[model samples]
Target: MKTTTIRTDLPREEKRKGAFMILTFFGIMATAGFLAMSIDLGVVAVFKVRMQNVADAAALAAAQEISIALDEISDQISSGNVQGEVQDANSYAQDQARVMAEHVAELNGMFIDPQIDVLFGQRTLDENSGEATITWGVSPFNAVKVIVRKDNPSQTAPDAKVDLFFAKMFDNDQVALRAEAVAYIDSRDLVVVMDFSGSMVYDSLWRSDSIDKLGQQAIDDGLYNIWTDLDSPTYGNMQFDNDWITIPSDSSSSPKVSLTWKKSTVDITTTKQLDYARLYFSDNKYQNFSSLSGQSKTLSGTGSNSGKLIKYAKVRYKENGREYYADFDLFDYDTLKRGLDLNGVNYPYPSGSWNSFISYCLNDSEVNRAGYRYQFGMMNLVHYWLDAQMPYSSTPELWKTRHYPFNAVKSGGSLLCEFLDGLDFGDHLGLVTYDTYHRVESQLVPDGWVSESVDIGATPITDDYSAIDTIQKHKQAAHYYNTTNVGGGLHEAIKLLDEHSRYGSQKTILLMTDGNANTSDNNWSVPSDFSWNAMTDYNGDGVADYTTSDSHKLYTFVRVKQAIDKGYTIHTMSVGANADRDFMKAIAFAGDGIWVDVPGGTTVAAMEEQMLQAFARIAANVPPPKLTHSESP
Candidate 1:
């Protein structure tokens, strides 16, 4: 120990030992630095983990909120009535977005201005593609990549990736949410009513080049095409004019014809109240005008006496098993060229008419030769044709016919006598006149010749007699006025149609018209003093009680309401410009039907195609109503 102390004093010489000490100190410092780095790295790792968890939660929360928002959006869109309201949708959507964003921000302790930026809605979903798009706002980072798609996660991938912190590098972060959805709108119910009336026949104006400047080819072609396709057995067809007639493809089959006269009469009155019933319900103006407009709310006398009488005669002809003519008979080339000389009122006949008329007797060519006039058996053939083509009372006016002028003769003008003569009574067909006019004899000719035995009575006799007399009188009044009543035809046809229909089958209606309701001196009721320019007889007295304020509008209201009440999905088409577009539109709007306006300037082929397309559209949109046993009843 004494020797060591002596050496320590001498170490003052060893003061140059600074290098070794420095080395030792530096090594200690290096180790401390390594430890400090390990601690800092650990802290960074923890922060990363926390950030990831927040991102996951935020994304999922946004996704769910968006889904709810979509549901709200859909409800809002469909909430408004047909009038169409929209701002409500935007408000609801934005509210939902804010709530979702706030909740996410609270959980993560991150600042965010969560909201939805409503954009103009201009896009429509591609239903076939199953795709939708939506626009939204961005916050914090200004922009980010995201896919806003439908909520059907089932269609999404399980390992989908969503970046939450990528935008954080810009010192800004915000949860952006989006979603898309689709809802279906449907309109599906249909009813079709087809018109089968006498006016469907070709008139001289529809044929003559002089009067019919537009040409007959169009009408002829269109009608032919339409009729051929409509003749299918799968659909319902009725032949109606002032009455209902069933033209069976198979003569032996029970014709699917409804006797509207009887049915309508029965619907309004029974045997006991016939005479006591308000022979005049509402005043004449109201009652008559109402009937003409297809309203007839008061249900005056049973069926129109004229309609019933026609039906009676038709039934007789049917019972006798007579044959009627097809519509094409009046247009044979030869018969058409021969021209009609109705007391010097020369009129060109359509070639097809003559051909059609002859179709009842010999082959179609019998009337093809130039100046060919089949007079020998023409009356018999015409009678056969008349019997076969009996019209229904409710047939649409477009389908009815009145004065069928053949060979332009003043004769062959009276359809009433022709109707009765076609019956099994042979020449006794004139007996109906006898019943009405009290005739002892039955010899009446078209040339104003009456076999003394056929002309007996003067005063009106049976109702049937009176009805025929009306037809005769109409035939003599206005040449064209004698044309058929189409609405009446449809009414009759519908009645007959019910017979063949059973419950559960689809019921459809297809109505075709050439013009509006027939207008005659505006007298829907008996010609009275007040109704010379009045509308209705509300008092039920025979006088004109109601004046037409909006009678024209009433036409649409009545027709549409009637169709709707019957549970029919109506489809209406105008044959030409002759129809009232406004009225047609009203009818279509009220019944949810289609209004097809046949172009006036277009070619017949084009017009027909367009009409058919319209028909197809109607057929596509509406499913027929399911027939019920009560529907027929």
Candidate 2:
């Protein structure tokens, strides 16, 4: 017992230190466990987000496929192929949905192995309560619900499983992830009314060969002969005089052929050529004929030579070692002379006709081949650009027929088809065209309307392929016609939308034109004087109406107001320089829509881009989704 208590105290102190060390070690182990758990949670969260994205894409794919299946079912029923049985239709829809989901999922990511569940149904939301409900197995099968799950034991095979890195320490090696999406075939009634006016037949630029050189040579050689034929007492009153005509030294640059004549009794050899030629006619004498140099006029009028005049005039002349031909207006020269004299300055002398005739000739052969033709206006550019974008599959026959001559191209109708080809599933499209009259090229129908009959202008079908096929076929057959009837086109489009569009669907009209409302037939009630018949009634009231006039513009405006009042959106596109941009803008403004102006002289690529952007904007402006219910539970 001698000092042993002291030794016991030291041992007790060592034991206490050991106990403290054990507590510290345990605390460290607990902290590390929590850190591992956090890291595992972060990894799981990343996988979960990725899986959700995959599921979203897969669900969309499945919904689209189901929509297509519904279209097939409708076709079968319409064709008397499918008997009265819902199971067969549902089975086909389920199979297609599963297949499409797996395909899209595989494309999105490699780690996503999902089980897709599809339900054909309708989703409704109570406006008063803000509550949404889904009714399954609904008739018409306009909606599809897609559930995508990974590692869900209750789901079918090929469930998605994500491996754990740090959570394995807690005896968890993997985690299951799931997501879902629902989609409905939004019934969209769209009308695409394009211009098929006579201008559409022209190319963007004409070839240099379009000039009628042979006709121009005849004019140059026969102009004086015609003067000789106009016999009168005043013809010889000025007396016959010495005259000499000198061809221009540099016709390409100067474009002037000097004509000098002397009436005075002077030495003919000493008389100098007049600095400027003057033509003495009945009441007026035209001076400074050089002013006529380089002018171009389209040859057209009521005359025996009208056919010859409508094409072009070529004034052939020789300058330095090159032979050149210039464009000139030969037919109706008297009328042209009067028009040029209206200003009372810059008169067209008889010599000025030659000078003016040669003014437009570019001596450079390359320029002649590549120079832009004025007759081929902005509308042609739009058509050419659209033609360039068409697929080879759709262009073979068109190219051989329409595009081969003068390197001409198809119209904007093809571009509309190309756009339709890229549309999302469940979008419905209709086609219309306007010239002298509005023609229904194709009726409004869902994304899948591919019966052969549909392609041949029959009513829209509910087949297995894309509605774009029917639209494209119709567009290919479109041809240029005389006159622009925007009112008629819009009227037909609105009527189609009003009559055939499904309830609760988005309605749109795409009105395109290259010109103002200049043409009106008996159908539109516009008088021959191009004036609005103010007394005609538009609203069916017996009284003569002042509110609805009878001009093409008033008719179009009335239709636009009606469509707007009915909640229809209209998008207007002015395609060419002739297109009345202000009119189009007003129409779009009235309809609460957008106006797209592709002005003249822009590149083809620019035209295409503008058109595509307009369509994209309209598509994006759809009403917000009615109800999107997630299948999380």
Which portions of model 1 miss their true places by more than 4 Å?
A: 1-182, 185-187, 203-511, 519-556, 559-571, 589-594, 599-607, 617-633
Name model 2 segments beyond 4 Å from true: 1-185, 202-422, 442-480, 521-550, 612-623, 628-633
- lDDT digits (tens) for residues 1-633 of candidate 2: 555434544556766787888899999989998998888889878776776676666666666664454344332222122223223554566667767767776676633333326565654433234244556776434455655556744323456466677777878777777665666545456677767665542323232221222232222222222223222111111222212111122235554432111111111111122221223322232222332222221112223322221222223334454544433322233322221222233322211222232222213232234332211222222223223322223222232223211111122333333333333323456767777777776543333222244442443311112454344443322244456788889988887776655555568888877667876646544234332222233344554333333378877876676676688988888865456776787677666677777553333444444544444444333333232445311
lDDT of each: 0.31, 0.46
Error of 1 at 383 (Å): 12
Range of the 10 consecutive residues with the lowest summed lDDT in candidate 2:
261-270
Angstrom error of the Cα, residue 68, model 1: value is 30
Model 1 misses residue 559 by how many Å?
Answer: 4.7
Model 1 over residues 422-450: C-alpha lDDT tens digits? 11111111111100011111122333221
Show how many residue pairs clash in every candidate, following the order shown. 86, 11
* Cα TM-score per model: 0.28, 0.38
- Candidate 1, residue 334: lDDT: 41
